[model samples]
Target chain A: MNRFLKILFFALLVKPMVLLGLGLNVFFKAKLPKQGPAIVVANHNSHLDTLVLMSLYPLSQIHKIRPVAAADYFLKNKLLAWFSLNIIGIIPMQRKHIRDTSALFAQCHRALDDGDILLLFPEGSRGKPEQLSDLKRGVHHLIKSRKTLKVVPVMMHGLGKALPKGEMIFVPFNCDVVVGDAIPFNADAKCYIDSVSNALNQLLALCMTRQSVVKDDLE
Target chain B: MFNIPIHSFYMMTFVVILLITGSLIRWRLQVKNPQTDYLELKQRIQSWWWMIGILFGILLAPTTVSIIFFALLSFLALKEFFSIMPTRQADRRILLWAYLAIPLQYYWVATNWYGMFLIFIPIYVFLFLPMRAVFIGETKGFIRSLGTIHWAVMLSVLCVSHIAYLLQLPVKNEQAGALGLVLFLIFITQFNDVCQYIWGKTLGKHKIIPKVSPKKTWEGFIGGVITVTLISGFVAPYLTPLTMVQGFVAGTLIAISGFVGDVVISSVKRDLAIKDSGTLIPGHGGLLDRIDSLIYTAPLFFHFLYYLHY
Candidate 1:
């Protein structure tokens, strides 16, 4: 029943609002992973980021696409927590002080193990709207032991200006989502994180230059 | 049920036939030149089907739906205008109020309140917007912000709303009613644009405005004016109250104003160093790009009919 409601929620509300309310220009959509056992990392801005990223996939595969959000923020109250968990289908990560790093992303690792795609925002928390912040290293830690996982870097622009943090009203702004080539899990932690950061930066540059993959390839 | 003029059906049929012809030409071109890609033309043709479908649906629906649809278009156009132009951080709230005015403006149209509709944007919005921005306490770029915001509302909302206002106009002919006028204006304007493009592509020479819109040429402009004027003269009596001569004059006005509107928008995009307004329509670039000619023609045709018929 919850799964049915999740699909219904996305199909009815989220998809239309994301498509119409905020016009999205997705580039190199072919690079997105069709199935799971992968991580889609993007720069976090507005709360709409998760929805926009999730709406990129077909509704049939929506159950497999899990977004990793902060437990404290999403699970702060009963209603939000229930909605986020059941409807949004987010895997909450505890952001508080943790002695063991493995326990923190255990839920994320389990999701990936279940052949589910994880949508991660490596910026830890939503930073200043429309500006990229430092990486929190949580994503790198999550993917360290998982060598087979493919990390796809995505850069989203204009959502922050549309509905940034603390703003209730949404200004209709055209958004751009650029997907980069998938990166295999690197053994070295520094190399892995650097590669993800570099991939994201390159995607950001694509948005800045307004360069999109050939329209024919979009098919 | 709401009334859709018989002429609208004929016009829609004509458009569909044109679309079929366009598709056939593309198919033939593909067969002749296998290496050359016709993706852009293909995308454009596909978009036209969707556009015409939505337009005819609205025309068939009740008057309130048409008003609401126009209001949505105004909102979307303003959103595109705001998106492309540089907006000041202080005037963000002011922009919201500008969006809010869309429904109110359309409400006036729905109620047939012409007196209020005419002055609400030009007088009230014109005076109130700058005052609203002043409350933000940011005096920087005051003139620039107010200028762009005011122009955005005027072009996107006030000008475009005239098309919706046509539905409210009292008409002499019951068969055509107001829908025919709406259909006539929109059809002629879009038709004029297509005529200009074809003329320009085939026999274009002597660039009209090389600095702003490089592709526009004198041959195309004159060819479009003559063709649209003649077509307008032929069809005006059937669709509108205008006689053959009046239709010819109206067509000439629309053809010239449509060119002006296209160039005006082209200049705005040129200033921003951008090609298109936004990516709302698939091949057309944006709603603004598709309706740039309508922006000018709507108001002019509305006023022209208002003075003569209404």
Candidate 2:
């Protein structure tokens, strides 16, 4: 039933709603790994961002991909909790438990161990749509603890315009989910958080420059 | 029973002429310019066939189906227009209302409620959407966001809904009927686009608006308008309630208004920094790209014909 609901909700309703409802055309500039146990990190902008990013994955991965959502927000009510946990397949992290990150750590490991793809916002929370803020330590520790995990930095623009962080109405704006090359974590990798942050910035800058080139060609 | 009317034959004749012109262009290109490629020209003609197919399909379908068809086009075009406009996230739910407006506006047309159809988007949607935005409690960029959303609905859904309404106009011309009015308006406006482009290419020198659309030229604009005005005079006697003079005026009206509509949408694409609205139609950028002129022309013609004849 959960699988059926996931297929119905994300694959059927949510996908078309975001793609057609929001008038978004999703393109993956970077090739995705056919099989993945990679930890995907992105800058959070809107609630639509998770759906937009998830849509980048092919339909076969509807079940394997999980977004790390705030447990308290999505899981506050029983029906929503069931919808989030079972239907959407989101891995909830209790943000209220400021110090105890281990529970989330265990859940992430368990999912990855089962060869499921995981998505996380390294910023810890949604920020101003355009600004990519300083990276939090949670992402660094997560990568460092698991040496074999590959960290893929994805940069999405226009989504901040599509549905801003604090806004409820999603203004239809075209968004791009740019995937970067998977950065494999090794024991002694220095400043991993800063590097991932820089990579995302680079990807975003590259997209902006490419967009200008398209405009120039139009001229 | 959906019987093909005399005006439907005229419409089919115009399409057939377009088909022959395409074949002639292909043949001429093959023989005369062996080294040059006519891919773009070929693609344009190819897209036309698809457009004609969908349009005539709807015209031949039951009235309910035709209404549904235009409503869907409005939905897609509005979706594309709003998708790129700078709307804030908190106001996302407001878009649901905007999308809802498409079917509702079209429903008014389907039921032939002329008074309600005319004012629904202009009045009700205008007032209702802001309330939705305000409910979200976000003040920043509120006016800008609200205006763009409302503007998109008005242009894409509301104005385009007038096209569907034209089909249901109470016309006394038995041979023509409302379908003729719909076809006359669409054919003249859309073909005006093609004529101007061709005329501009052949004898264009002066750029009308270089900054906005570099391709538009004085020669093309005049040539296309005169050509459409003449064609409208010829068709109106059979298809419309207008006399030859009125037909010429309507043609000129459509020509200028069509240009305004084209450039208006061009300005939008320019503002949004997009080349095309969407890629729904092959060779035709998006649905909006093909129908921009008609969006402005549809309602204008509907009102003009409604007052003059209906």
Candidate 3:
């Protein structure tokens, strides 16, 4: 039933959303490496960001990518719990009782341990829409235990405008997902997260500037 | 049911002529200014082909097909509108219900339930939307979010559905049928937009609404309105049920409303700090952008013509 539900949800619901929900061209600034166990990190903005990022991948490999989301938030209700756990197969990390990191760490480890691509948002909480917030160090802890964890910084532009935090209405906006080259985990928690943050900031800035410069010519 | 309006054929001919003229101008510009940016021009022409093609295809096809085609357009436009709207997780189910209104609204047009069609959205959905959002128990941005969804439905589904509803107009004249009226509204609305832009570029020195729409100029607005009004004196005889004087009034109404719609959408994009609504059409920014004028003009022109016919 779980497998059946997953297939049905992905095939019917998530797959059509790219063409229907965003309803615009979604450009990929950089592509992800196929067949890899990379810990993909991006800044969290809207509830739709995870789904938007999920759409960045091919439908066949969509199953391979599992987002590590806050269990308290996503699992707050039965429907959401079912959606997050079964349909998308997101690895739930506790947010409420998060001081006790052992269990959460174990789940994170288990996800990577199983050769699954673990998606992480280092921002920890929703940031200002269309702007990146402070980057947290949760990702460094996740990859510290694993020897061969490849970390990639993925920047999502415009999902925040599409579905901003605290707004229930999803507005149409252009979205671009830019993935940086994988930085080998050097056990330098601060350095690794900072570099990832910097990479995303550059991409976001570049995207904004290019849009105005190139597109405004028509006006 | 009314006969295939011969004016519909005339409307189609006008569209073909406009397309040909646009192509010739494009060719002239490309040949003359080899270094200029024709990307915008090319995109505009490309989008015109698809838009006019789909429009005529549906207009000429069975009435049912046209209704369905427009319903699909409303869906796409609404979907594009929804992407920027921020909805709560709890309200996803409610949002689904909101989307379902698309077909239901179009169904009213297709079935020709005029009273029910008119009230289903404004009275029924308008009341139900807020209550539905409240039932979901998400309070944050409730009014704004609900209003956004409601406005989206009103604009995309309600306003746009007016075009499909034109098929239901009970005009029996085969030579100048009601479909010609539909084509006329679309023809005038889009051409006014283009004519305004061209005149503005060539002669506009004074800005009309600089804050709202930077491109709009007093010179362009007058030029566009007069040009469309003069053209209406020639074309409106067959395309509409109105007299020559009445056609001029309708033309002026449509031209002004076209400017209003363009500025209205401009204000929206300005608020959102975005360039275009969507990249749905190549030259056009988004589906919403293209139909911005139609949203305002369709219902107004519909009622005016209906009153005149009756």
Model number with the top TM-score: 1
Instruction: Please give the range of 10 consecutive residues that has the lowest summed lDDT in model 3 chain B.
Output: B83-92
In model 2 chain B, which range of ten residues has the least summed lDDT?
Answer: B82-91
Runs off by more than 4 Å, candidate 1: A184-195, A205-219, B1-4, B31-36
Instruction: Kindly list the per-residue Cα lDDT of model 1 for residues A1-219, writing each as its tens digit.
Output: 999999999999999998778877687999999888999999998999999999989999999999999899999999999999999899998888566888887888889889999999989877766677888677778877877778899999777767878888887777779999988777777787888888888777645213211122122
Candidate 3 or 2, higher DockQ = 2
Model 2, A28-128: lDDT tens digits are 54655556687788888777778877776677687898898889899999999988889778988878776776765778878888988888888877786
Best by DockQ: 1
The CA lDDT at B301 in model 3 is 84
| Leading candidate by lDDT | 1
Runs in model 3 deviating more than 4 A are A1-14, A21-25, A28-40, A44-188, A198-219, B1-6, B20-37, B85-96, B134-147, B176-178
TM-score of candidate 1 on Cα atoms, chains taken together: 0.91
Q: Write the per-residue lDDT of candidate 3 for residues A50-153, one digit (tens) a residue.
A: 77777667666777788988887889999989878887889888876768677767877776667778788888877666567788787777777775767777
What CAPRI-style quality would you assign to candidate 2?
incorrect
Q: By lDDT, highest first, what's the ranking?
A: 1, 2, 3
Candidate 3 structure lDDT: 0.76
Give the lowest summed-lDDT range of ten residues in model 1 chain B.
B1-10
* Local distance difference test, each candidate: 0.86, 0.78, 0.76
